[model samples]
Target: MAGIQDGMTVMVGGFLGTGTPEILIDALVEKGVKHLTVIANDGGLPASVTGTTDRGVAKLLSAGMIDHIIASHVGMNPIIGKGMNDGTLKCTLVPQGSLAEKIRAAGAGLGGVLTPTGVGTIIADGKETLTIEGKEYLLELPLHADYALCRASICDKFGNFSCYKATKNFNHVMAMAADTVILGAEKVVEIGEVDVDTFTTAGVYVNYIVGGEQPWQI
Candidate 1:
């Protein structure tokens, strides 16, 4: 978390509350940085929605740490609307599939992606569009970040990571899209303890590791 500073662009791995690195996120809150541009699927569940504590990115949102967001949706958290209406926050909403492809394009080292998702909608406004074979496509550029926060169900000392079911949502691809990847795991083991085939993401993409994350309350 030391490498992340004010005004940095951060990609947070999650879909709602799932697959989010809560421990690492809390550490960022404790780090007290500001003016961050966060890229994610959703804004996460607010305490009001969870009926418990704030979950996932809601922690940062409530602390007013993020100044801007590039996400698919933010309806889960009411704060997003309030902040935007007051001019304290800036938000850019991308289609879910397009957002995923943009992140994937970055990881794949591609210039951009051609998608027809927003052709007749406002999402295509001010964006470059091209017609090939009578179909229109928008040019969505790769989305990179200064740092990425990812969650894992288990990880070895060398960072071979694993997560089950919905937990793999953004964590896998996000690891490859950032300059540095910080992993927060529910369990950590030594090398060879877990079979190599069980690993979903290779260890090579991870930069730092933190362990003992509890299951998300949400």
Candidate 2:
């Protein structure tokens, strides 16, 4: 079915909006794909904040399906934090900006990038440092995935995707980095429905499209 499987690395798009695909997330849950490694921000939040308890891929985290996560933060999800403390969830937190650049580099087929976000912090603990000009920059490696789970505001039948406002976070670079890209959207339209200027991810990057469920009330 060209679906997700065990031991696969997945990049989930969204900071809080544009990158989440509610439909795809549900499908993954229905399929019960296990032993997964996810890369993104905010695995999911509690139902109080997000109207749908299933919001933000929290379902997977809660079901004990995932094995590892590489993200900027876990958001307001208490369940995932508990899983971490209990040794059920393994996590690696990265700087938000560095995470974005690393994914972009992967999509661009670059080895990695040099950034100054963690020059003297714990983020640099095991990383290499280089002096560029007069400043030191930490080298963060490129990060990609076997599959990418992302949300678009709208997607044409031809697979063109558009993100609205802050929702556009991470989807663009994530689309490029994954071997397979799945999209969930609030609306689906024809190829010409959206202006080319506003299209953040091109049709070429998408492999599947599903209509997203209404967001949880967070």
Candidate 3:
């Protein structure tokens, strides 16, 4: 894949550190891609007590590569809070389900998603509200990205993918919502090797495939 430019909105598939593409993220860090707007489920885990960092979005955050983040949670990574407090980074918190639906809506070419998830809280502020029948719902805009970095436990030469356990968290939806989708696969195999029943994401949604470091090793 080509290098990522500054100011691009990127969706990184993960739930905390579970499904993040660590190898691809390492590549991004090595390439020094800056001014990125990252979208993920969580901010990622902080550096370990031994001073070695080996988890999710925190690696990008530690390198000062991301300019903004749109995620469901940010409490686990202290770097995120520090960056936000120092005004070096901007953060937007959306309800988890709402965030997922927003991305799905974008992929499906919907105008927006109407949900009551944020009805009477700060989440409703600055957003449109519509009353259907007798209940009110907030209009959450669709969310898309210039690129999506996702993890797959198994990827074919043609880019079809399947993940194990929790690794499937946001990878499937993110692959559909991005203009360019890159898959970091723990094991790359022939197209027919992956069982059709196990295929969670189709090759049509993928643009590139890279060998990935195992999540457990990270």
Candidate 4:
């Protein structure tokens, strides 16, 4: 089976609240994969920020494994800056909402999506510009990855997934666009344990399942 490897691009699912997938991140670490390009919302906790065991992508960053980062904000953690300055990390910052839409467009097989988020700013520098009616829009290419790391509230043996409350962030869209998808879950049950009405992510997108991390460990 295709597993983690060096020099691969990975899409990670998480947002401030319900989106973090601690288990999947840990699994990647355990796999000892390196030279990665990670696309995510933010850097996970850092040793300087929380002072406990490292959680989220922080563990990967601390390991000096990642080669590039495509994220909305890396400044939330101090170690990220040091890594960037010291040439251990390379990054490209995209707006949060725009980042989500880009992943969705990629998953849906679209070439790109049009948006006005970064117009008239540094983000518009080298991108194509379009005028629809009287408003201007910037075309952002869709983002897909070699692998997508996601987390869910519960999943069945068949791979269908659902997120709880606010944590549902990018997990849903990233699942669709990646070449391979792996999920971290709080609970796993029979295929029918979760009702069809609440099913947000179907089984076809997921490939593996790992348990979740301790409560708010990251």
Winning candidate number (TM-score): 1
- Candidate 4's residue-wise lDDT over 13-105, tens digit each? 876423677777776787788899988888876766676767677878888778998889887677778878888789889999889989999
Rank by lDDT, descending?
1, 3, 4, 2
Against the reference, the lDDT scores of all candidates come to 0.92, 0.81, 0.88, 0.82
| lDDT by residue for model 2 (1-218), tens | 15688889988888753357767777787888788999887676556666756566677787777899888878677777888899988989999999999999999999999999999999999999999999999999999899998888878887788888788888889999999998887888877776777576788989988875465343
RMSD after CA superposition, every candidate? 1.0, 1.9, 1.6, 1.8
lDDT tens digits by residue: candidate 3, 105-208: 88889999999999999999999999999999999999999999999998889988888998889899999999999999999998777577767778899999
Give the TM-scores of the predictions, in the order they appear: 0.97, 0.92, 0.95, 0.93
Candidate 1 segments whose C-alpha is farther than 4 A from its true place: none
lDDT of 1 by residue, 92-198 (tens): 99999999999989998999999999998999998999899998999999999999999999999999999878888888878989999999999999999978887
Off by over 4 Å in 2: 212-218
List the candidates ranked by TM-score, beginning with the highest. Answer: 1, 3, 4, 2
What TM-score does candidate 3 reach?
0.95
